[model samples]
Target: MSIIIIGAGEVGYNVARKLSQERKDIIVIDKDEEKVERVAETLDVQAIHGSGSSISVLKEAGIERAEILIAATNSDEVNMVSCLVAGVQAIVPVKIARIRDPEYASNEKILGKEKLDIDLVINTDQEMVNSLLRILDIPGARDVVDFAEGRIRIASFMVEPGNPVAGKSLAELRKDYSNLELVVVAIYRDHRVIIPRGKDRLKERDLVYVLGESAAISQFLASFRDRKGVAPPTKVMIFGGGNVSLLLAKALEERGVATKVIEPDIERCQYLAQQLDKAIVLKGDFTSHDLLEEEHVREMDAFIALTEDEDRNILLALLAKTMGARRVIASINRVSFAPLAYQTGVDVVVSPPLLAVNRILQYIRKGKILNVAILPEEQAEVIETVAMETSDIIERPLKDLKLPSGILIGAILREGQVIIPRGESVILPGDKVTLVASSAAIPQLEKFLMVKLEYW
Candidate 1:
């Protein structure tokens, strides 16, 4: 599809780079000639200089030929107006607007597709918050990817020396917990994605990926938990009150998780205290070891560092890890700091640019089927698809069905029992089947599972 992206910022450039790799024709527009020229020179894309919201600028970029128009300028007004203009004048089939203002996000009537001309709205803050909380669920997991309406998940965690999973093999695990239905896909051992065979044993510091029902993943996690009471609703300790922290704290509280925020700014802390009830807000410098210790950092099930200063967040997250926090997550906006954060004791590292890239990628692919969600770290993809009544999936049992390789049907939420399929399992109309596919087959994953129905 011919794509035109506005704003030659890092987020815009990253989106163009990713889409260009897929061989899409991309054109980027930016007011600053320097950024436009720099991005065009570095990436395989066209550069158009002008304010993206201007009608003349849209026309010059061949918006009429563009299948998708993305307005991602930092300003919410620019993004919304640019997309509206593209929708009304350029006849673009899909228009995605990057909204930065948090207030506009809550006004669903204004941002909703039915009310606004925009087809999609991207919110990086909300996406990052979701990622932060998700990474905390599995104590040692560096990454978490949810599928099947969040019912099935794939998580990757490092097995340290004292970890329970460090000395176990898949076969032994199955023999010991025969009722549990979880599959280990790959292990990052000796710097490679080792396809674990039945005899392959988990070792210390090995990063392993496991796929299973959400409950099964929880059960598996329970085995490794240091001491389990009634599984606490993720007690989280955050080290900043920046936009990311505020958004994350609100999201956590909404999910019934306890959030404790430590910020040095008294005014921000007071604001947070007024805005959030489920979260405990504190005004103190988390960098001070005494302050962190007094706040009971070691008792926190999960610790996140989301301050604007990447160095501070990284340093504090590492400190929390050293102080015996089970999970440590840090938000590093700079790509350079990403490697360092991961190398340090921080368990999970999230980069805004990467999250923005994934969001834009989803916005561009609108014609295939129903909803699409790409898993973090490019590990997996979860798509909600409707199986056609005439499709082969309806006639034969799943075992007899010649399903695509590297793809497994995790669950069939047909009228809601969440059936973990057996050999005789069959798909019917209105049945929502959750599938897990490895990275290699993600592009063609949906093709093998559902037949896209089109109207005349």
Candidate 2:
């Protein structure tokens, strides 16, 4: 596919890098020659220097033959205009733009994606809030990747000493729960990945990668704790009153979760206070240890550092964890510190650029399978696909089914429980499944599972 991305920022660069790896003809355009050159040098793709919305620039970037046009510059106006110009022709299968403003988000008419000539509208801040909430929904989980029509999920969680799976073996767990179809793919023992062999045993403090329905992930976690009804809805403490924090606080409040926010700037704090009634807004510097203690950081269920400074965010999150917070999430826009944060026990680390790229890919390809991810320094990917409707496996019991190698169902939310399909499991209608597979295998995987049925 000929994919042209306008803008050489983090989102654009990430999209270009991913598409290029699939051996697609990729081209990137930007006004900054230095930024354009930098991306062009790092990724195996073409680049042009100019205003992305300009007709001359679009033409030079080969929009005529491009199958996908993505406008992801920092400015919403530029993205809208660029996509509009691309939409003039129906040849492009996907035309996506990044919409950053929350105010514009409320007015769908002014930026009603359909009216804007953009096939997909990506809102990074909102996506981050949604993603964070998903993590919070399932307490004690380190990472949650949904796949397989939303029925299946791969959740990574550390086994606590008092947890149910603390001393259980994979075979033993299965024997006990015969009705469940869960698989153990990889185990992180002492910061290492152990591709499971039947004889391996699960030990306490091990970070396990489990494959099951969304409910299974929760069920498995609950099994560990004493039948205490749902880890008391997390008492969330957020540091910073930026746009992202405001959205997060609103989202949390809607869910009836308690949220306390600390911001050093009086104006931002006042602005947040006026806009949000659900969360407790306080005018104080979160940097002060005295203030954090006074606010009961030690008693917080979760602490999120959303300040603009990456260094400060990491430091505060670490401190929160040290202070006995059960979970700590840091919003790190810089990609480089992701590994450091993870290693230091940061429960969840989110990056705006990474989130932006994933949102844009989802906007561009909604009906297709797209698993977006990044492995530290390496450029991440968005696997695009369409599930085949012709396969006999559709709606069939998973135990009686077989999936291609290198492909794992991340989630399958069918009616209710995100069934992490095990053997003997069945597929159902209207299930949103997320699959993780190599970029090369995505097309073949889609073809294999494509199901076709006869209808009256």
Candidate 3:
């Protein structure tokens, strides 16, 4: 399928890069000549320098016969306008636009079919907010993704020395914790991906990926935690007064958690003070030891750095951890800096680009894919799709399902219940099946999940 992508920013560039790697027919449009040149040099795809919303630009990018158009320019207006123009000028089946402004994203009438005709809208800030909330909910989890309307959650955690499950094999883990139902989907060891087996042992510092029922996943994590009976956090401090911090403050306040926000700009701090009821807005640079000490940052349960500056966020987060904060979270947007942030030994690093890209690619994926979550480093994917009644694989038992080599059925959600699939388990028509598969197995999965029209 042919696809046209507007802009060469992180989100758009990443989407194009992945699609191009898959050998899809991709054409990228951007007004910046340098960006287009960079993409053209980096990936084997066509790049045009022009306004994405211009009808002439669309025609130049072959929008008429394109299967998808992604308006992902940094500017919300440009992205939305491009989608609108694509809707009017082309027969693109899928029009996905990246919109960051809450004003435009929160309103349905503005993006409805009668208005922008956008098939999907991706809001990076909102997606980051959701990620922050989930990470806060599951302390010690570096990343979390939900499926089947949150009945199942896949989480990533780093194994630490002296943890009970650190050196255990998959078989031993099952035998020891049979009461807790969870699956170890993938293991990231020394930056390498390993699909676990019954004999493979988990080592300290290994980034472990687990999937299961929300509550069960929490229960299973107890074995590897070194909390010493300490709870997560009731009081949290966040640095910056940006949109992400605003949304997080609102959520934390609603939960009655004592929250504090530190922003360098007094005007921004004042704005936050007026917007948040329960959270305190402090004016100071968190990088200063005197300011952090004066504000009693050491006493806070958790400290989060949410500023747009990646380097500043890392510095402040490291300072917080050094000052005895129980947990520290930092936001890092650049993919190149992600590993460096992790190496800094911060409690958690949230990448907004990865979060946004995963959400956007779900639209382009084949099948009745309910949700698509790609793991860090593109090692594997945790996919959840609704099983169709007429699909050939639905009525068979789990053990007999002809899955690809790297694929594994992690869980099944039927109605409101969570099922840890056993060999005898059978998937019914309405069940949401969650699977964990390597990158090589995705095409096979897409074909399997997509119901052929000729089947009837």
Candidate 4:
């Protein structure tokens, strides 16, 4: 199957890189020669320096043979036009666009099946805000992803030295906390990801991903928190007046939280003030340490840096943490900057591009694949998929299935009940199973799901 990706920007580049690694036929189109060159040099895919919305360029990129077309340009108009042109020129089965404009996103008729026929519309800003809210809901979690309609959650937490589960093996933890309904799926330590086993030990500063029912996950996470009890942030100070910050402020306001936004641009601040009813908008430079101090940054329950500047966001987040803010979240656009930001003591790093890529992957992997959540740095993914009758995984106990090394069955949703799988657990056809697989093991996983040939 041929896939045509428009725009060689972060989102487009990431999607192309992933698909190319999976050995899919990918062709990238970008008007910018430099970005097109970068994609051609780095990825084993065809790159064309041409406008995505141009009919000639679509033909040059072989859109007629493309099974999937992804429009990820920064301009909403360009993205929409690319999809329309693809629909007109080819029988592309799926067209996904990254739409940022609220006006276009709110109007279903404009992008409906009768109109644009877009298979999936990704709103990066809204997805980022929702991800932030989920992280905020779980106070100490580094990342949180919901599956099975929020019944199952894959939450990542940093294992502190003093935490109860810090130095314990998964087997010991299972014996100690026998009633807890959570399973350790993956562990990230020293920039390496480990598909954890029963004997694997969780170390300090290790980012551990656990999967289970919502309540069980909460009970499991409680062990990572201190006795003082971490409460949800009641007061949030956002350091940008962009669309994402505005949306997040509005959501927080609905939850009755005191939200404040500081922006350097006076006009933007004025616009934000007019748009927001309860959230306070202040016109000031985020670089001014005195201004932040004057606003009692030390007393804030959470400090968020959502500015366009990645360096500024990381530095401000670190400064906020140093100023005694309870939690600091930074919006990083570059995937390479996340580990460094985390090393600098930033509580959480949210990447909009990565979030967009994750959403797009869900649609690209058709039938039986219900959802996909890509872990940080593309180290791993937690996939929620249904067991198909034609697959070899069903009607047998999990242990006898001869699963690959870097894959773990996190949870099984049968009928309405959630099951934490064990060696004796059997997977039936039509059951929703969540699997955590390392990046190296994804091909094996696709083979097991019997979607290897279908994916291409």
Cα TM-score per model: 0.83, 0.82, 0.96, 0.95
Model 1 steric clash pairs: none
Model 4 regions more than 4 Å off: 227-229, 451-456
- The residue-by-residue lDDT of candidate 1 on 325-379, one tens digit each, is 8677788765446556777667788877677766665555432344444443444
The residue-level lDDT of candidate 3 at 244 comes to: 91
lDDT tens digits by residue: candidate 3, 234-315: 9899999999999999999998899999899989988999999989999887556888888788888889999989899999
- The model with the greatest lDDT is 4
Candidate 1 runs further than 4 Å off:
32-38, 112-115, 162-176, 185-204, 228-230, 233-235, 251-259, 277-280, 283-287, 334-340, 363-384, 399-406, 422-424, 438-440, 446-456
| TM-score, cand. 4 vs. native | 0.95
lDDT of each: 0.73, 0.71, 0.84, 0.88
Model 3 pairs whose backbones collide: none
Q: Residue 161 CA error for candidate 3 (Å)?
A: 0.7
The Cα RMSD in angstroms, rounded to one decimal, for candidate 1 relative to the true structure is 3.7
**What are the per-model numbers of colliding residue pairs?**
0, 40, 0, 0
For 315-399, candidate 2 gives per-residue lDDT tens digits of: 8999888887777999886566777888887888888777676656554333454555432243222242433454365668765
